[model samples]
Structures are given as C-alpha cells and as structure tokens.
Target: MVARIAAPLRRYLDTEAGSAGLLLLATLAALAWANSPWPDSYDRFWHTELSITLDTHTLNLDLKHWVNDGLMVFFFLVVGLEVKRELAMGELTDRRRAAVPLAAALFGLVAPAVLFLAINPSGEAASAWGVVISTDTAFLLGVLALVGSHVPTGLRLFLLTLAVADDIGALTIIALFYTEDLDLVALALAALGIAAMLFLRYLHVWRGPAYFVLAIGVWIAMYESGVHPTLAGVVIAMFTPAYPARREQVEEAERLTRAFRQSPNPEYARAARLSIERSVSLNERMTRLYHPWTSYVIVPIFALANAGVRLDGDTISDASTSPVTIGIVVGLVLGKLLGIWAGAYAAVRCRLGEFAPGITGLGLAAGAALSGIGFTISLFIVDLALDDPQLADEARIGVLAASVLATVLGWGLFRVAQARQGDMPGRPLKLDPPVDPARDHIRGPLDAPLTLVEYGDFECPFCSTATGSVHELQDRLGDRLRYVFRHLPLDVHPHAPLAAEASEAAAAQGKFWEMYDRLYERQDQLTERDLIVHAYELGLDVERFARELVESRYAPVVRDHVISAEASGVGGTPTFFVNGVRHVGPFDAETLAARLLETAPAA
Candidate 1:
C-alpha cells in the first residue's frame, strides 16, 4: 500500500531537508572565503594539482575538478537510484498520477531554455540555458517545511514527483548537449562497460564489489570519452534492480532469524543477514547506504567548491547589467513559475491528469514558484557551459538571486493560501459522512459505545493483515465495538474496483460480510469470471448478481465511499478512525484495543 511507500519517502525527504542547513552554511562559507582578505587562497586551494600515477600513465586533475568530476558521481548515482525506484514502484508507476507532474517537468525544462535563449539570443552565453532547468531538491523541501503543517501531504508528494521528473530532464541534457569532442574508441569502451553491467544484472550478481569495480571502469571510460563522467553514475543506476521486499524472502529471513535465536551460531547469524539483505533489492539497499553520504558530504562539498564567486562592487555592477545574468534570473524565476503552472493547468483541462485531492489552485502555484530554486544543478551546468570566468560568476550570482527570490515568493503565496483556506496547524481530520448503520456495512451492535471505521481496499495486502487485527479486536471487545467497512479501492490494484462492486452486489443480497471474507481469502482470483464464481458459491441469486456486476450498478456506491475517504484525508488502505478521529501509527490488535479503551466513555 501507499502507506508503506510513504514511510521510506518521508524519511528521504526528511534527510534531504535536514541537510539544507549544512548546505546553507557551506555556501555562506564559500562566499566568505572568496571575498576575504586572503581571497587568492580560495582559488589556490581548490586549484592545487592532484593526480594518480602509474608507469607511463597519469590521471591528473586539480582539487576542484576532483570534487566536481569525482565526488559528485555519488550524488548523481543517488538521483538516478531515486528515479529508477519511482519508475519501478513509486509515484511514477501510475500513469494518471504521474502525468501532471511529468508534463509540468517537460514545460519546466523547455520554458527555461527558451527564456534563457530569448534573452541571450546567440552567443556562448546562449548555451548556458541548462543552468535554469533544475530545482535544488534539498532547498525546495526545506523551504516547504518552513511553510508549516498547513501544507497538505498531497502537495508535498506532487512536488517531489515533479522534482524526480525534472532531475531526469537535467541528466539527459548533460549527457547529450554538454559533452564535446567524443573520443569514439573510449565511448565504445564505455558502451562495453555498460553492457558488462547489464550482463552482471542478468547473471543475478548481487555482490556490491563486482558492480563497484564495473562502475569505476565505466566512470574512467566516460571521463576519457569527454562525456561528463558523472553520467556513468546514472548508467550504472539504470541497470541496478529495484523491487519491494518479496513475501517469500521475508518469510525465509524470519525462519533464519528464529534458527539463529535458537542456536546462536556464527553460520546462522551470517545466513540470517544474507537472507535479510536479499529480501530487499540492491537499488534500495545501495540508496539507503549512499544517500546520506551524498546529501550531507558530497553535495555540500560541491557547493563549497562551486559557490565561491568573488563578489565585489564591480562584479555586482556588471552582473546587474549583464544580459546573461538577467536571462538566468528571468528563466529560473518567471519561466519555471509560469511553465509549471500552465502545464499542470493544461493537463487538468485537457483531461490528461488530475492533481491529488486537497491540492488547491493556490497551493499548486506556490509549489510552482518553489520549483525555481535551481541552485545545485544550475552551478554544475554553469561550470560545463561557460569557459569565461566573468560569465560563470554572473551565472552563479543569478542562480543565488533567483533562489532567494523564489523562496520568498513561495512563502508569500503559501501564506496567502493558508489565510484563504483557513487550514490552521493541528486541525484534527475527522471522518466525513460518519458511520450510519443504515448506509454502512456493520459487524457489531448498532448502539455500541466504540466505533471503528476502516477505509480499505480488498486487494491491498496490508488491508488483509489489518483484517486479522480487526477480527482480534472484535473477539476482545465483543458488542462494545461497532466495526464498519467502507470501500476505497486503489488504482494500482486493477481488480480492486470490480471486487468492491462485487461485494456491493452481494451486500444488496444481504451477505456483504460473506463476500468480503471470500474476496480477501482468494485475492488472486478476483477476475470478472472469478467474481461470478464467488457470487454463485455464496448462494446469491446468480443471475441477478451477474446482471448488477455487468451493469456496474454498485459502482456509484463504491465511488461515494472513495470520495468520502479522500475528504477525510485517507490517502492509503486500511486507514482506521476510532471514535470518529483518525488513528496514526501501528494498526495491530493491541494498539487498536488500547486506543478504543482510551476513547471510551467513562463509567
């Protein structure tokens, strides 16, 4: 269910946002070091030569190049890993859910380039348009956190999905437009390295060392081929497999852990460790291992190296009048804002996609404005696109200025939105269309003192587990608890809507709970024919059930529950509301029972 996915994603966002403070300090330090009395030290220190040598061969670069071309590869690798994971099983897995953001990302890229080019027209500066095509994910999320709890979770998710698509666009531009004078032989060698990586994946080689060596080979080849070596990170990540933890693998891990608990042997411990590791995909494992290092260390180091532009009165004056600087400011600030908003608007209007529930127009515009904080990749592309020192400085200045202005603009818009919507912090989300015995499927006494409502999907594995927990609570609480089930079939579960409709069809025959149990008990067998089989097995009027399902007579009833769930802020399956208030955290039998007792009327 989405709740499982949201846990990891929330952790990722938190880590990235937490690192923003360190990144800010690093940027300020860079500016200070560049403008200090010992200004030349900043340049001299970063430019000091460093190299590795072998017999008749040397790999040489200055310290700055090492940070940019070397350490930053891990940063790109993390980005690539996130993109792959999203495409595999995260937000981007759903076409309808992803369409709006993906379309906005497309325009987010195109509009910035067009605006940059329109201002610079034709010159070396025109090539620097890549500078405005990205949003700094860390800064974007950090600023969003500043907007307080009034910001809906859906809006945060929308922006994160948009950022993923935006990252893909920037990576493609770097690999295609920025490279020059390709050494065909080295490029061919890089191709071979990529092929070898694919072969390893095909061979089911999960060893990190093997892939690490191949990644190094590909990075070196890419460097020699004049294609930005950081791209090798992306290439390696593409071949890295990502999948959810398999149930069988998890069961195997549990078995091994139990054996280890009994025997306490070295072999058992090692086996248990390997079992747990194999249960999770390599891409997720590596992302967890590498993301922190990249966010807190490599990215800030890159910032410190790249953001140290020597700001002086003359430099500021020149940048103020410079067309390149003006273009970058307008491109990132105005272009991203207008482009993202317009693209999202068009997608909804043209019926290509819809925004998440609870995302208002003003919130969308605020998110669009925040997309203009193009700091990290902007500075990165500035290095690749401009050879002139003054030009690069102007670009960096523009990037900094745009980021600050965008943050202010976003904050102001969010303030206006919160005021208009009256969504104050700590507002309790209560169940809408509160449970009614007449209109709901109830399994306990109508006048029970405690009420538990579940907005769940038949096909959700988590909901199936929650079903067991609910049965336990029913056994313990008896007639004191009134349990109600509502339909909220998710789009990812292809069979879930029909399954809900089938349950509704049975409900009309006065056997709703019977059909619910049968469906969850045989989830894999929920095809159209399978639903008919279930209806016949339940001893319902077979022809009548078939006719209702064929006509989709109960679809509106299921849809009404979905609408109510969304209005009540139920984003995922098996969401529980106890005594009319939404429950947070674990949904085990003991947890729910304890919560029910706490909320029960005093004796």
Candidate 2:
C-alpha cells in the first residue's frame, strides 16, 4: 500500500526534478532573448494576437496571454490534482501528521506578505504581496535532491505537504485579491458549469469527453467573468475523484487478460483495458497523464514567456534601490525561513503535532530555507500585479535573486546538519527497535543465528503472495532462521487494522502464527464478522477475540510496529529486513536464501 501511494509521489518528484533543468534553461533563454539585440522581436512575437471564432462570437488572446492563461491551466490542474490527492489519502489524511506542515504553510504565506507589505505598505507595490507568498515546488524539490542526496523521507514529505498548503493559499489570494471587475452573468454561467461537473461526478460519469467539454465551458465563462481562467482547472480537478485500486476491479482485469490470452479476441482485450482503467481512479489517471506534460512542457514554456527581463546595468542599479525588489527579496528569503521555523517550532512546542520519524529540527529548518525559492509563482504574480515593465523586471530580478540565495542557504544548512550528525548522510535504513522474541511474533528457534523480519499488512495482496516465499524459506532453513512479523496496516486497506488486531487477539491466546496464516489465506474475507468466524475456526476464544477487536485492544501494538516501520524507512508491505538491514530487490525464496547465507556467521 505504501508503494501504491508513494509511487505517484516519487514519480511526481522525479518529473519535477528532471524538469527543473529545462525550467532553468528556459529562464536563461528568456533573459538572453530579452537582453540581446532582438529584444523587440521577443515582445512582438509574444504579443501577436491569436483568435478562435465560432460563427458570431470570438475568443482572442496574444501569444503570451495564451501561454499564461491557457497553457498554464494544465500546470495548475496538476497542482490541484496533487493537493486533492494529498488531502484525500496522502499525508494530510492524518490530522496529527498534517498539523505542522499546515501551520508552517499558513505562516509561510502570512509572514512573506506582511514583510512585503511592511516595506511597500500602501500603494501599488503592496498589492503585489502575493508574489512572495508561494514556493516553487519543482525548484524546491530539485534543489533538495541536488544538495541532500540522502535527505530524510520525512523531511521531504513535510516540505511536499507544506508546498501543497502554500499553493492553496496562493491560489486563494490570486482569486480574491487580483481579480478584475466581476461579470455577474458570466460568473453565474461559470457557476452553472461547475455545478454540472459536480452533477456528472455525482452520477459517476467517467467519460473524459464529458468533463473536457464542461471544463472548456467553465474556462470560457471564467475568462469572460473577469476571473482567471486557470482557476477553472483547479475547480475541475477538485471534483475529480481519487482512490486506490480496488481489489475486485483488479481481479476482473486479471480475468479478462487471462481470457484474452486464452483466445486472441479484440473483445477480451478491450474488456481487459477497460477493467484495468476502472481499477485506478480518474484523478490518479489524469495526474499520471497530465503531470508530465505540465512539468516538462507547460511550466518551461511559462518560464520562457515570463522570465524575460533586460538585465542592463541601469536596470540592476535601479532595482537595487527599488523598494519592490528589496521587499520581495527580504520577504521570500528571510521571511519564509523565519516564518516556517517559527510555525513549526510553535506547533511542536504546543504539542499540536510532531514531525515524522527521523525528521529533526535542522532538517525542517533546511526545508524551510528551501521554501524561500519562490520563482515560478512570484514571476507569475508579477505579471498580474504590476503593469509597468520596469517594476515587473525589478520584481523578476528579486525573485531570481531570492531563489539563488535560498538554494545556497539550504545547501549550507544541510551540510551543517550532516556534519553535526557525525556525517550521517541519510535516515537509517537498519531494522529499528530490532527483533524481540518476547514482543515480536516469531517463528522457528528464538536463538536462531539468522533473523528475517517482515513488516506486512494483512490485506495487502503482495504480502499474501510473498507468504509463499516465506514458507519456502522456512522449510529450507528449518531451525537456522527465525522470522518476525510486524503489522503495518495501510489506510487503503479499511479492514487491515481490525485484521491486525484479530491476529493480536489470537496472540493473546497463543495462536498468533495461526491467525496470521489464516488472515493471509483469507485476505478477501477480512471483514469484522469474518475475523470473528476465523477466530472460531482457529479454535481460539471467539468471544474474547470479538471483544478485544471491538475494544481495539491491540491497536497500540499494531501502531508501534507501524512507527517502527516508518523509522526503518519501510514504505511498502512485505518489506523485509535480512539480519539487521533492509532487503532490496526481489524477495523470492532463492533471493532470501542467498541473502541469508551471505549474512551468516563464518563457519
């Protein structure tokens, strides 16, 4: 389940990291084009008008506006999809887990705006405060990857969560503060379009074309209503559903594929494809489809369209004295660092939430420093807030300078952290807490020379499949190996926690291994009532089992294993620790046997 959840996040980060180079290149190209002899051509090309006409009505925009308002919609859509996913099932699902990042993000927004306003308090410059309020997630993650090769997963997750929340605040500010005069009729029409989309979602309409047409309508209506049309992407994405793959849908896909394999028929093939598509939610599917395009193409194009600023000595000399430039630099680089640090500190001190396992104050501080790299959205708001080319250029320079300085600051802090921690490069991957025969559910000899620990979920299909390999290893190794099983039930598996409790309930009656085997054997039938029935079949005290499950007697025990799993960098089910180190790659019987033999004591 962790693999299922983390896979998308990992992909998202990797894509963002990969695209950072392209984004940088585009920014550099834009600056060069603007500063070169062909600077007039740069402006003229972007200002060339393009129009779409339908009978009596027409929609028109210049090249730069099209890129900013149209192409960037997909970028915001990707952002919206990620935020929705996180809110629904990712790190933000747990309130305790979400509290610190949420606080940090909120403070990150407020402090920057306040600092910007303090410097440019009342006039047009103050209106541009939103420029400092967002962090460029791509650049932030990219820099983190570059500077800290072994940064703790918890810190990365914390920063990701903070970025999501910061985006929400930034988008809200754009909508509420930067919008032009309202067009009531067009706004009403846009509202109706959103309503229609919600209705389609309610009716379980999965057809892409239906949503696509409605999204276009909303975008058009928003464009006419004096609201940023890009927001339509966010609205549409918020209504798109996200969920883990369903077991029944997966099983059906397997059946269809098998049928297709048996007889070469297009009907079976189509059915298999449809079944596979239905197994994953539309939100996940669209994110996978569109995120790469946004990260690799649209965002770079945005940078190219917007990052141009003539960096003449006069412009630089003027910007050095410009309050707008000074405000943005101080707000983003200094304000974000201090604000996020304060918020995280307050949250931890107030006991509102604690950082994830393996995350330290230094790591959090490093992440906060990186948050000051507000390149993408800072330049984005520059266009929206400042009409004068000179002021906009100054703001752009401030944004670029803040990003460079923030990167250096973050790199320095991470180095300091590494040195202070005795040059420990990354989070420890060894088996945390170790195996205790008295507490852990162990099989084979307690004093066995070899130890194999598995952090597993009762309802995880992969874990069930891996049970075969475990059985094989046990048979071959006999008394030479002992296996420890720990519960790490995932949120996707609704019944897994209860099932884990059932095993613990059985353990209270000295049948832990029996119940563990039975749970895996009947993975599909792990309902509360089914668990009670399994207790009966196992010849345990069914009444005590049912009572303990009802009372959640073993929840703490299961939670302890989960905490230990996180501390040990276990991200998925069937995670094995051979001896004291995590096992990578295949977990087949042959692999496990070979690894165990390799780790065995000499002679």
Candidate 3:
C-alpha cells in the first residue's frame, strides 16, 4: 500500500505542472476557506498553540509559526542548495557568465524595496519593504513552463539565478533588520551548535541523524535568540559539500556494478549499492531527496496556511488606497519588470556580460515581466513584516493582485513575442562546410535521399533518449534516411565534452557506433573509467583510446562541430536538421517519420 501510494505521488512531484497545480489548488482552497461562512475557523486553526518543553525551558509557538519558522527551514535549505550548486558548478560558475543575472538580481532586489519605501515613506508600512523584494521561484518557473517550449533554457537559467539572488537578499534583510530583542546566551548557544557541526564535518562524520540533531539544536538556539530559526537551514546548506564523486569512488561503483551483474548475489548487490550511495555527494543526495518535498508538499502547505486572507468589502476598500497595497502592486508589476530589464540591458551595453545566444531584447523584457509573479515569498514576507491584522490582510491582497496581473501581462507579452518572432521570415538552414563523409559519423547509406544531421551530447539525458528514437527512425527508413552525428556538448553537463571526446576517440578506431550505443545505454555511468571499459568491450585498443581521450586528439573535430552547430542557431542539445532544414518541435521517431514522409514528395 505504501509503495502504491508513493508511486503516483512521486510521479506527480516530478513534473513542473504537478507541483504548480498543487500550489494553485492550495491557494484556491485557502481563499475559499477564508471567505466561507466559518471564516474565523481559519484563524483559529492556524493560531492553535503548540509547545515543547525540555527541562526548565519551554518553546511555545502557534501552528502557523511552526509552519513558517520550522517547516520553512526546509524550503530555504533547498534554496541555499540550488544557489550553492549554481555558484559552484552550474551556470554561474564563471564570473563573466554569472555577471548578467547577478547584476539583474541586484537591480531586481533593490529597485522594488526602494520603490516600496518611496510609496510608504514611514511608520509600520515602511518596514514591510521586504514584501516586494521576493520573486516566488515556484510560481515564476511554473508560469514560464506553462508558456511552452519556445522559452530558451538560458532564459530559464537567468530567471533561476535572479530568483536565487532575490532569496539571498531577502534572507539577509530578515537577519539584519527583522530580529527582535537579542538574547546573548542563546546566540552563543547557536554559535556553539554551528561550531559542533563544523567539528563533526572535520571529523568526517556523515551521519544524517547527527547532523539533524545539531541542526535542531541550532534552530532552537536561534529561535531563543530572537533570530528566525529558518535562517539556520540556509546556513547549514551553505556548508554542505558541492563536488561530484571522486575518481576512486567512481571506480569503486564500476567494480561493484560489474561484480553484481556477473554474480547476481546479495553480497555483490550490497557492495554495489554502497558504492553507488558513496559516489554522489551529500549535497546532491539532499537535493534529490528533499527538493520535491519542499516544492510539492512544504511550499503548498505554507501557502495553504498563509494565503487565507478574508476578502470582504471592508478589506477591498482598505486595500485599494492602502500604502502597503499600492507599494507592493507597483513594486512587483512595474518595479521588477523595469528593474530586471534595465539591469540586463545596462550589463550588455557596458560589456559586463553578454546575453545568452538566441535571447533577444524583447525576450529579456518578457522574462522581466514574468519575474513580477511573486506569490510564495511575497506572502511569506508579508507574514513577517506586518503585525496589525488589517495591514497584513491589505498586503496579502496586494501580493495576490500583483501576482495575478503579472502572470496575465507577462503571459500575454511572451506569447506576443513568440508570435512576432514566428511571423518573421524563416531563415534557411545552412550547415557550414557541408557534411564530409570521411570526417562525419554516419549510420546509413551515404547516397540516402534524406539526410538527418543531429547535434548531440552523449551525457545529456534528452540526447540519450533521442538516440533510441533515432535508432527506431533508422530501422523504419532503411534506405531513405542517412543519419550524421555532430558534437555539441553543453557546458552545464560536466561530463558531456568528455563523453563527446570519448566518442571521437572511438571513431578513430572504427568503433564509434559501438561506443555510442554503450554510452547511451549506460548514460547514468558515463565516467571516464566506464568509458574505457566500454571501449574495451568493443575490442578497441583501450590504452590508445584512453591516451587519445586524455590528449584530446579529436578536440579540433569536436570544436568544428560545435562551431557548425552555433552557426546554425542550435542553442540546445539533441537538435535535429532534416534535409538541411531545422526540425522545430518534438524529436521522436513518429514525428521524424511523419515529417520525412511529408517532405518526401517535395524532395
């Protein structure tokens, strides 16, 4: 029964729509519950006090506080992990490449707070400036995903980096400006807990339970010290390791897996499992385990608990002229759009950083407008910033209004941009230098009527899946289809270039297809050692293959392929060109066959 329930839940959490849909449902439910006949029950339920006592100390908090201060720590921890991963190994690893989004996030953060402060100059309202500084990552990404596949991956990365930066800015503000009266002893205790965690790390203690205890201790201490306990989540995640599996770790996994496949015994299974577990870092493990929980469960629960604002005539009347409402509405819908666009534009103008290829000025503006769909973090902040019930309700109204407006406006603008771009005359596909039979990797007759050229990365999951479809297409059209493969390794996939290089090295020995088949079959195990093992299985000179790979003997060919791909505007992996024209949509065997047959008469 547990397994049965977990399967569908896991499937639901995997898709962008599933997570977003849950959040939306929760928001609607909250609004309905809040406005229903039994409205006071909404407040009553959330305010029900819960207390924990340890010796002489007792920590008492309402149910809402538990969700905000305790459960939200998990949410913030995931945010921290994403930020660290991006900065360490993802898109923001390069300083120059990182500049555009970092600059945009800075502007995106400051402009809104400044605008909010301007609208609500003084008193209790001014303190709620943090409300406007948030871009709800879930909502923003959901809306973008809903906009369809034309949204460039680079633009998605830009928005992700921008949201992460916004999170950092918001957390900093909360820590610096939002704390109550400080308790020195409790602060010292929190410091001591953090120190203990570092000591455990130095001692090479990887036990989850040990970390949990120390983290809880720190959380309790922070809460007692008048600091928001959720900040501890970010602090702890910042210290988690970021690198991938080490050389020996990968080797061990390969050995164990080989033994398990050969022997099919419990001993081999245990060893292989242990090796596999040891290969990935703690950060990745945590991310894989907890990200879905935070996104689909914790965040939606937070929305359900906090998004229940009683919308009545009095609330509407107050919200219309309320400084908090006006500031947040203006800040999110106007300030974010202008601030992010201006920041990106200025960066490009000043040569600070160039925009991602295929991303235009209008696309950036559309993305900027999308950034204003602030729901989750905006609600979280309003909860923290407002004390008076009326003010809090007004702020909630503002956030909801702004988010709805932003979504509609941003969606309209993006669709318009897509239509405009589509309406322009289509450029003829031009592959430079033509396909050289000697240099290219071919799978079918050279004189085949239709040529399908693929720009692919071996380590990319999509490309690996695409290879299966390409094979199906090959089988379906034995004489009519000619398949050519080119290297276009993406920078985000660390092992992609190496995998491409390995394929090239195999091509040097006339076993390129064998290596290609094995790589895609074992896409999860594309480590260097595994690549060499695959080479050996294909009866290649393993020593020469490894040497050629290390020396990058085929680097020039791979570079040429990448150059050709760029010239043809291939911005992503698994790009397909059929009969010298780019195929714009799905890359499945059925689609390919239909397209081929459709154009066969013309050819």
lDDT (CA) per prediction: 0.88, 0.87, 0.81
lDDT against true structure, model 1: 0.88
List clash counts for every candidate, in order: 0, 0, 0
Across 353-448, the per-residue lDDT of candidate 2 in tens digits comes to 976656778887888999999998888899899998888889999999999998999888998887886655454678877887777999999999
Query: Candidate 3's residue-wise lDDT over 1-603, tens digit each?
Result: 011111222232244345787899999999999999999999999999999998998989999999999999998888787777656655556677678988898888888888988999999999899888878877787888688666664566567667777777878888887888999999899989988998997996766899899999999999889988888888888888776446567678989999889999998998798778767777778887788898889999999999999989988998999999999999999999989998888888889987654466778888888888788878888888889988999999999999998888889888887888688666326554467797688889998888888999888999988988998998999988989999888777877778888998988888888888888888887887888888888999988887776555565466557656754667688988877777889999999888877766354
User: Which 10 consecutive residues of model 2 have the lowest summed lDDT?
Assistant: 1-10
For candidate 1, write residues 48-104 as lDDT tens digits: 999888898789999999999999999999999999988986888779879999999
| Full candidate order by TM-score, most accurate first | 2, 1, 3
Candidate 3: deviation at residue 238, Å? 0.4
Residue 94, model 3, lDDT: 66
The lDDT leader among the candidates is 1
Model 2: how far is 252 from its true place, Å?
Answer: 3.8
Cα displacement (Å) at residue 204, model 1: 4.2
Off by over 4 Å in 3: 1-17, 256-272, 425-486, 489-498, 501-603
